[model samples]
Target: MGMEHSILVRVITTIMPALVRKEIQDETDRITGKSKQISPIPIHLSIFSTNDIAQTPYYDFLILPVVNLTLIDLPGLTNVAVEGQPESVVKDIEKMVRTYIDKPNSIILAISPANQDIATSDAMKLSREVDPSGERTFGVLTKLDLMDKGTNALDVLEGRAYRLQHPWVGIVNRSQADINKNTGLSFARRREREYFATSPDYGHLASKMGSEYLAKLLSQHLESVIKAKIPGIILLINKGIDEMESELDHLGRPVAVDAGAQLYTILELCRAFDRIYKEHLDGGRPGGDRIYGVFDNQLPAALRKLPFDMHLSLQNVKKIVSEADGYQPHLIAPEQGYRRLIDGSLKYFRGPAEASVDEVNRVLKALVMESIRETEAMVSG
Candidate 1:
């Protein structure tokens, strides 16, 4: 019995994941403009273990694409009954459907009542309630063995058409005898099904647990897939300050009065800037050159006046690199852009003595934002 219950639980677990994947695929299609169908169906486990309804094994499952989200009222039929119960059932069914589907547009009621008379009253109340709203409600009542005969009988008495079929009538049905005969199930295999039948609640709880498990699995998979497709870019910049320290060590003039060494440092600095700029612009990095160009153009005229005669001081070189560091064009792209600009600007301008490099970086960031806004306007227009 335990083994049979395990097999049944496994089947539910396997099926629920597929259903969840289908829902995710449908949602993705709608977002990408490929499909118009939107399904309002809440992910749920169809509890087939209930004893009130005959257990009908499902052989095949059909996956549906996106469809408009619709409300579905599912009425549970047990022994409980009252004289004024039809209206209450109708209202409860409607509320349940709305909550389950989470859609206000279309509503469908799947009802199973104790008898034909009660089923008819329930259907009528459901139809009338939804009729004024101009939404169609389908009442599906299922029975065993007999298919269209029951539906036809109800149709004639109600003076309205009601489609009746077996619960698993739409699904391909096969008998246990047929399965056993075809597969040549041994004594051990037959015992499994018999064992599973003993534990009724096992199947029900497993189905609910399977649904929750699938929901979590699908959520995680979707998040991973999305993250893999879109990745963040990181850019690292380093000035050659370490190399200069080695050269200064060989010079005996307190590393300050060596004009030739200073000249070399300035040349190296200029080369580093040029290489970075060119790599960003012509190297085919995404948003690379466009971003680098903003900083390049924003260099102040006063900084450009620095002599390349190799006589510049350590203070000058430090000032140049510091100013360049402040240039952050990437921050001007959108909301992120504004935040980067504001942060960079505050950092560059907050001190009593502003470095020339910091001023240049701040101005460049502002210009980048302005340029982005203008470009956006042109595209939007």
Candidate 2:
């Protein structure tokens, strides 16, 4: 149990953050009945004298050799297999490590994005084989060697012997320069539009035309569709129009055309929602049916008439049941049947709960105003 506790907490925390640091220490202390204590072991305990390498720049890097070391304990080889051979179980530790770490660009860095990618790739490769009983089996080993000149003292002390250097030198520097150039080009393009193309006079004209166009389209579409007259849809469209009007009322408003563009986007959204609602009501197939009504044939005749398809209504029901006979809704409410429509739409919009026309327009106007102010400041300052 002590070995198991240490292996689970120590190995996982090595990669993850210090959020679980206290929890792990508490658990370790509970199991071992030993309070944590700081050791005063000499930094160069592995060597007889540190004076020989004192003057070297690399000496600073070797102050603590093998600083953060962790050991993982895998009790037994249960579900283990080899690549391309499903029947082969790797009982040998050296063979398992060699197969896992030995590959093109196989040198694993201690702390890097590449480490995550490599670990995932290696896991996938190992997953190809199954245990002898045709069951999925795999286990993590105990030992890991993290060698990097930047963070690993062993690598710094040992130099080229332990440190795994990158294949192409100075690649990151070139990539950073390219990123900076792209950012500068984007900023220049934005400035040209703010100053030369859409000055105050033209910007206002454009905003008005765009807003009017969007408002007209929205009112027209809502009337044509939503045949039963959805009050919510109507309210949203009117609210959008009111928002556009409020923005126009602002004194000395610049880029009025861009304001119109924002209003039009709202109008188009109303049209889209109307179409989606109609389709949903019309029994258009939704993505990945959670509604188990399709499998109603398997249910008893009396239970089948229960309006709501509980299995389809809930997620993960299919996985819990062996066959259709075992299916049951833990909670069945008649009003909850249409709850999917509201939830689905809310998710689709990805907007705030108070997504009114005026708020959206105000938000857009503020954004445009900020952009204009920023460009002016950059040019002047």
For candidate 2, the lDDT comes to: 0.35
What are the clash counts of all predictions, listed in order?
Answer: 11, 8
* lDDT tens digits by residue: candidate 2, 164-219: 22211100111344444443434433443443235432343232222233334434
lDDT of each: 0.39, 0.35
Q: Estimated TM-score per prediction?
A: 0.24, 0.13
Best by TM-score: 1
Inter-residue clash pairs, candidate 2? 72-142, 206-257, 207-256, 207-257, 211-260, 290-312, 291-312, 292-312
- Candidate 2: minimum summed lDDT over ten consecutive residues — where? 165-174
- Which 10 consecutive positions of candidate 1 have the poorest summed lDDT? 1-10
Error of 1 at 16 (Å): 18
